[model samples]
Target: ELEALADPMRKDVSVVRKRIDVVNKELKPLGTNVQKKEKEYKDALDAFNEKNKEKVQLINKLVELVGESERLRMKKLEELSKSVDSMQ
Candidate 1:
């Protein structure tokens, strides 16, 4: 009777070990796939940040150019007004 009980218990343990090995085999590839996806996400985020920085720089330069153009136009207007006043 003892021998019969021990044999079943051993078989159960062997089944459990096989199941664990199968799960581990499946889990390794899943872990590697997760890592690859994480790297891809990080790379995309980095590229987006770099493009945003460049966009900000271009906008700043545009604002500066607009301000300079306005200032020059106002100066020219003042010169024209002064000349008109002198002619009268």
Candidate 2:
């Protein structure tokens, strides 16, 4: 009777160890998934930063172009004023 009781207890311990091993195996995949998601988030942030940088550069170029256009218009007005004065 004692041996029979020991056999059941031994089997129970063996079953518990197998379940623990399965849980350990599952943890590796969970860790991998977490790492993959973190990397994806970082990559997305980098892409956004690059896109914003391009936007800023284009805006600056547009501002410079507008300033140059104004300068040309002012020069034309001055030249027309001088021509009228000379004619009079």
C-alpha lDDT (0 to 100) for residue 53 of candidate 1: 100
lDDT of 2 by residue, 1-88 (tens): 8987768688788899999999999999999999999999999999999999999999999999999999999999999999999999
Q: Which segments of model 1 are wrong by more than 4 Å? A: 4-11
* Candidate 2 segments exceeding 4 Å error: 1-26
User: What's each prediction's TM-score?
Assistant: 0.81, 0.66
Model 1 residue pairs with clashes: none
Model 2 vs. true fold: TM: 0.66
Question: TM-score winner among the candidates?
Answer: 1
lDDT of 2 at 34: 97
